[model samples]
Target: MLKGILEGCVLKVIFDNETYGYEISQKLQEHGFQGISEGTIYPLLLRMEKNGLIEATYKASVLGPRRKYFTITGKGKGELEDFLTVYKEMERAVHHLFAQRKPEADSEENTGFGEPEWEG
Candidate 1:
């Protein structure tokens, strides 16, 4: 469900910049995806690395232990592009479906659930 979408989102974030786990989670929250924990992010990062979509390097952190920073590989970039294409098609399809629905005014008129019409 959400995990599937989050994988693509994680890829996009890594594609945008090389970052560590906590920072990646923070970026997800900043982009309106709240409640995503570092625990979740780490597993996804590991999976991506295993899949060869991203590469990681150990870097010293000023605050604490060495951080494993992720950078998108060439394969990752290609996958991201594919995801973008699919996402855009889904977006357009959803928009078209919603557009075909009757407007609120029409709904109210037919359903008799809105304010009463007054005769002059």
Candidate 2:
């Protein structure tokens, strides 16, 4: 589950802008995903490229090293859309599960620990 979520996040980051491995890891960390290593990201990137969700090209970097910049494919955009749809539904369900409900005001029975008391 977390892997899929991370993959979606990676796709989203690439969708926003083309970036290389280290930059992508930094962005993920900056966005509150701490402890994500380059090792993890690189493999995922390779997998996504192989799966046709993304395409990578070598570009000259200012730091004097050739960087593999990743861009989302048309298929990736479609996958991202599908992820958004599923994510929204999951978000709604989680919100609904945690949402507080107002208690009955006119009940005469004692409510124990915030639970409605059963009349025997």
Q: lDDT for every model?
A: 0.86, 0.87
Residue lDDT tens for model 1, 5-111: 89999999999999988989999999999799899888888889999999999999998999989999999999899888888888899778755645554665454
Task: Give the Cα RMSD of candidate 2.
Answer: 5.9
The local lDDT score (0 to 100) that residue 61 gets in candidate 2 is 86
Find the 10 residues in a row with the least total lDDT in model 1.
108-117
Please estimate how well model 1 matches the true structure, expressed as its whole-model Cα lDDT.
0.86
Candidates' TM-scores? 0.81, 0.79
C-alpha lDDT (0 to 100) for residue 34 of candidate 1:
79
Tens digit per residue, CA lDDT, model 2, 1-120: 788888999999999999889988899999999999888888889999999999999999886889999999999999999998998899899787655344553343443224446844
Give the residue spans of candidate 1 off by over 4 A.
102-105, 109-120
Q: Give the TM-score of candidate 2.
A: 0.79
Q: Runs in model 2 with CA error above 4 Å?
A: 100-120
On the 0 to 100 scale, the lDDT of residue 51 in model 2 is 94
